[model samples]
Target: MAETRKFLSVETISLIVAFAILAFAGFVTARTEQQRRESGAWVRHTLVVESALYRLDGAIRRAESEERGYIITRDRAYLRPKDEIATQLEKGLAEVGALVADDSEQAERLSELRPLIEERLEQLQHKIDIMRAGDFEAAAEIVRTGEGKALTDRIDALVAEMIAQEDALHRQRDLQMSEATDTLQTAIGSLIVLIAGVAVLAVLLTERQLHALRKSSESLKLAYNELIAESTKRGSLEAQLRQSQKLEALGHLAGGIAHDFNNMLGVIVSSLNILRRKLRRNEGGLDPLIDSAMDGADRAAALVRRLLAFSRIQPLNPEPLDVNSLVIGMSAILHRTLGAHIHLATVLAPDLWPTRVDANELESAVLNLAVNARDAMPTGGQLTIETQNTELDACYTDENPSVRPGQYVMIVISDTGVGMPPDVAAKAFDPFFTTKPIGKGTGLGLSQAHGFATQSNGHIKIYSEVGRGTCLKLYLPRYLEDSEAVEAPPQPQPQPPEEEFPRGRPGEIVLIVEDDEKARQATAQGVRELGYTVLEAESGKEAIRLLRARGDISLMITDIVMPEMDGARLAREAVFRRHALHVMFITGYSQHAIARDGMLDPDVNLLTKPFSLAQLARKIRDVLDARGDLPKGKP
Candidate 1:
């Protein structure tokens, strides 16, 4: 191949050079053609604008000429021509307006032209009428020396301005054409030079074949690195997606648990309340037991709240929470949890960036984690609680399965106690996977912590070694975003047993909008016992049907989570049908019934179900009071 290259004929080399020249010419030709087409479009647009202005100028001139001709002739024939001129001028003015109305300068000129045309037309018509009446001297005086002449002069001025404008535009177009031609010439010359330079470069650069390949090899390495980076990013995203899927699965699990637990709590509380109310009614004694049962029910409520927190199903009411303040607030609780033997030390990062997290949930996670740390050190060891800023990039997230690349405030709880094995630590966040004796420790502690962190848009990473110690890093994502001001808690309004809430009021028309058969009857029956006329319905459909039948209803009490028709839907139908209707929703699944999506009308009320007789009565009375005071709308 080397011998063949060296012995190449001069004629063959000439032929190669000629072909190279042709390729260069082709590229230049294509670019020139594109520029020429663009220039033609610009020229066409300028011509259209100029043509419109010229038409206006011509119309004004023709009107003035016709007026002068009629004044001089004093003939009826001149009157016909004047009318012809007026009609033609009006049509021309309208045509030009349609074309150049979008141009501001032109639009202003057109506005000026309007008054001139009106004055000139009126004056010329007066002169023409005089001329037709055989009053040549008077008509000529009006045309030449009166307001007619002034009007005609203004019209003539407008025509002159229009002509000047068009002439200026034509000159500008000529300049643009000259500029484009010059630019095209320069571009063609530069392109030829660049093509020659490329040809020379291609020849000179090819001489050192190995060196050229070496540079190409370096470029290939760079490209390979870029590909690896892209692959790594893809890998990191896939892992995050998997974590998101896991969390979604967890959300579903939490919802199911919350549903059953809420129902149990509801039953427990309701039954206790019913028993106490009955005892009071019957004049039976046993107040202490009743009080104890109430206390137990309250405790059960707290326990349910904790379960909801652990599952992250409970809405995170994140506020602008200060980390230092939170840690300080938790100091007493942490110390009490760790006990006297364990040396509880807190190393909070100074000027620490604050994160938006549910303060209550944060406190729970910290306290639980500290207690776990205390338990790990049976022989007594130091426990350090440290907080610092953390930024996880793609590289870091790729290695850590649960973590995503983002900002966080890392709260590490390190213990000097007997540490966990790697295998044990791996399953630390798995629910009910604890090594402690039965009844000693609930496996939900660490699991709950992990869930809370993830729920707060962060992750928990635990590192441990069998004999050394455990370092549990709880990454709570840094939330710097501002949220809308949380509205004040709705003041509980206990209604009198007469009007609004269907469950409490007696004699008031109560519309039961519950879909569940058992719940609907219980609620309707309980309302009826309160002396309020209970209207029963198993669904929103039946509730609405009942409501339509009765026009005297004061309040509508509906369970939001209905099968055929939800409470909100029924409430809307009720309000539309009966303008004065008040609504109060009762639901077992409060989140499902009254989520962000389930926005009930502001006039409507909300009452969570499994409520007591007193609660039911009070709510009804309060809602009724509010409804009573509302201003009446025009009938």
Candidate 2:
């Protein structure tokens, strides 16, 4: 009986021990599950914070891009989304702030990020306001200062710091969650060893945990895909922006070409119509009409030349020049151009530094500026032309980023006339941008000057204010060499009637190659009238055949641009066949055909098209008489 009682006691103690072990295991599992739940919640919170940050960043980028688009295109469509973007930015920032509220480090980063964002927003709004006020230059200048970029970069850095902190927390929580899961599995295994039902329950819990893990992984993948899509969208926006800029520039060029060319063609066509009517009436007053027509033609040619200059494609003939001498020599012409009312004065600096530039282009630029000054003051005004040696320093170049710091010869053209506002002065150098009444200006004058200065490795700036006066400062790079400045040639007197149209020699055969039938016929007629035997061909291939068949061809005048065989290639072949053949090239504007790096070869003799019969006759005679003087090798 005592043995049975001892056995019962041992059985009861064993049962109690088993129950205690099961209770301890259950407590451990519950605690571990709770920890895992808390860890998952923190991880989700981190994701929310990261999502808010991304939203904020995207909103800022969109705002910046839209602002730039508005500035560039001046289209109100870009402004339509402004209010929505602003709301998004505000909401995103507030959400980010709320998400990071519990973490001191992240909260501090947010604090630092907020002001930069606000400042950037203010800058954007300021630029928009300036643009709305029609002060595009002021808005552009604000962009140039780089303050906006600085703010953005700072904001990005701070946001990155906040994100990094959140990532670190997320990693720590993930590790804690993993440890909790391992602990839960260990407890469940212990319980499974104690009871079969517990084993089944543990298996079910493991499957549930795995399912949750798969769901979490899918969420992360979705976020990653979203980020990638956003990146692609940003890239597409950048490409569109670049394309828009290109189209804008092309539009400006086309508008300038159309406006100037149409006016010139109108003049030519009107003069011809008048002449025809008068000839039908057998009128005696034909000289003035002929002169007017000729003047219109000359102006058309000059317009093309000016356009080339503005495009920086015209060839330059740089020579060491004393600007003072050039200005003094131009005094009489300036007086005639300005008229008797306008007072013109010169403040020439003695011992002024010399500059290397195209003399004819410089003269043209100066004449253009003077003409602008004259027009600015309809009644009367003082136009002062000044020259001085100056050095542009780094401080100046820092503000005017396009300029270089160096010694320069400065030509200052100041006028006491109605001045321009900041906005007008800003776009003064843009082709076809003008405030002058239609038909009064072509708007190419200042643009041509700007191009000439740039092509000559120089700079130009304008200073003006309403109710004040205007000053244009042209800075040409100083010539460092010690060579004496070339003396200005004396102006040519009017040609005598006998020497006006010098005729070509007898038996001097000239070959004319042009693609346009009318141009070719007119040129052939002009040469024949000059006493030269003319041979005409419509294409380069025909011209080559003519050159090969005729051994006595004295000169070949060809158009530069042609299909299949350009003038340059044709000239090469022509020279290959006849080594001593004299060639002259003519073009309305195709400098690239015969030019190298925007410079015409020294040996090339070129004449711009739309020439008078007298000019053509003179050129033909000169080419025939000057035979064997120029190199006959391929050019």
Candidate 3:
């Protein structure tokens, strides 16, 4: 064993020497590649210079040849060629000088060549002038007797000498390039042998690593498979959870719609019940019966209004309104709506700043919150709607991403009932997210309220504890504006028992454009029943088609939101085509779109939806009657 080990020393020394030689050879080869690149660039530049030199030489030759031809022919055509020679020769001299400018020896030679060339050019010019002046023999003598030929000879010699010098320089460059290329090839050959040995060693190392990696790969794959399986199971569970949450939210939203509908029904039934009793008592006056019917009509109108608001048909018109007035006005209705069981209370702060918000939407939101609070109570609890002033700052904005730094009117609705947990409270603003039992809510109330607040440039926050009551803070930014000079509720107008309209002339035409199918049909029915021609369309498309089909449509009623064309556009087109056509814009979303378009005439009329048979009759009568004076509804 000792002898065998001792023999390894010589082998190790030989290996080390071999590695040193390989490294030295590789270093030389790499240096040669850089040298080859520089040499190639230098050779390319020299070739470009050589080409330019040849161009300059060609120009010189053409000039000399043309000069000789002019002297022999004495023709203007020959003189034309000679005339080009001086310009060409000067240009050639300048070009040659530029080419050799970078080389000291070549530059000195160019300097010598320039003057000789210029002297010959001057002498040739004089000789050509002499010949042109009819002293042809003297010019011929100058050419033949070798008077100016001395200068020409000197210039031609200098050019030949310069070209020879350039040729020699080019030959030298080519030889040096050939030697560099051969040396580079020899170095590259040695480098390739060294790299081959290194590749063998690298392959030996890679095989060991590959064997180790293959052993661990199987274990990793099993673990990864298990992880993927577990993840798939969790994903399935999450999907099921989401589906449950969605269904629950739908149930809540459905309930809210039903609750509002039920309240409207109660109003109609109770008013009729009172009227029935009064009639049974043999009441002589018809005032009670008349009032009860009006009350029922109003209640039905309110129900439709709420539904439209929920369906996003109603537009939100934001304005500064005192929250105190809004709450007080709706407090009585909320009490009736929430029922006698839930205690509805208001805590309106004195001198509360008016917030810029949609008054109608805010009232609906308050009612929605109150109903939600009542439901959470289950039995009976105080549902307090509190209003206060709030001043937010950058510090508060940092804490709440949605809340900006500003002053706001905070309207909080609270209930002392089974409160929501943190998780439930956090998701309160999310549309269709609810904690109520099925058929007890329309998850939209809270979401609608939250959306209303946000759309009004306000913020909504929820605070709740499990088993404790929850408080909702709605922060509505304040607006600066003058308060309205509102009057007391006016006395009910003494309306006619039934409406009647005089028959119009046969040529009188009325056009109606409205978007809603049911509303359009109902409006058309009301107008037709009242003895006027009626046309109905579900969208702006049918209305425009009907409009284009006939010139007889005297009154046009179109919906504000139709598929292809909105009411505003239809109105504009109809009026432009027929100056006599009357236009009225019916819109469910008048809040966002009411102000725009040349569509509606200043005299054109607008009527909100869910209108009754009598209301429709009255509006049409009023709109048509006002048309006599070109009231806003007519073209």
lDDT per residue for candidate 3 within 376-455, as digits (tens), equals 88888667777777666553465567766667788877776787866788778765567777545546677777777776
Highest lDDT, which number? 2
Instruction: State the lDDT of candidate 1 residue by residue for 1-635, as single tens digits.
Output: 56555665554565467567757676766676576666666666667766766776677666667667766564445445656777777777787677666667766787898878877777767766776788888876765576866766776676667656656766776676676777678777776776776666556545555686899999999999999999999999999999997898688557645654565566667667777787878855556657756766775665566566667787788876777788888888777777788877677788677787888888888888888888898988777777777665543465566666666787777776677765788888876557888547546778788878878877877755455466777777666544322343212233344444344435687777665576678777777877888777777777777776788888888765445555666666677788787767664322211232224432445664325556677788777778732211112
Go through the candidates in order and give the C-alpha RMSD of each one to the true structure.
Answer: 29.5, 44.2, 25.9
Runs with alpha carbons beyond 4 Å of true place in candidate 3: 1-313, 324-354, 367-386, 391-407, 415-418, 421-445, 480-635
Alpha-carbon lDDT of model 1 = 0.68
lDDT of 2: 0.80
Question: At residue 364, what lDDT does model 3 achieve?
Answer: 79
Per-residue lDDT for 225 in model 2? 99
- TM-score between model 2 and native: 0.39
Pull out the clashing pairs in model 2: none
Listed in order, each prediction's TM-score against the native is 0.33, 0.39, 0.32
CA lDDT scores, all candidates in order: 0.68, 0.80, 0.68
Residue-level lDDT of model 2, residues 1-635, one tens digit each, is 56554345543465566677788888888888898899888889888888888888888888898889998899978874446656787889899988888888888888888888888888888888889899999999989999998898988888788788878988998888888888888888877787764455556656776898899999989999999999899989999998997798778778767777777777778878889999999987778877777887898888888889998999899998999999999999999999999888787889998888999999999999999988888888778887877766553565577877677898888776787876899999988777889778888999999999999989988866454356788889888664332553212223236456888766888999998798788788878877888899999999999988999999999886566776777887888899889988886432222242122453577765435566677777777677633323234
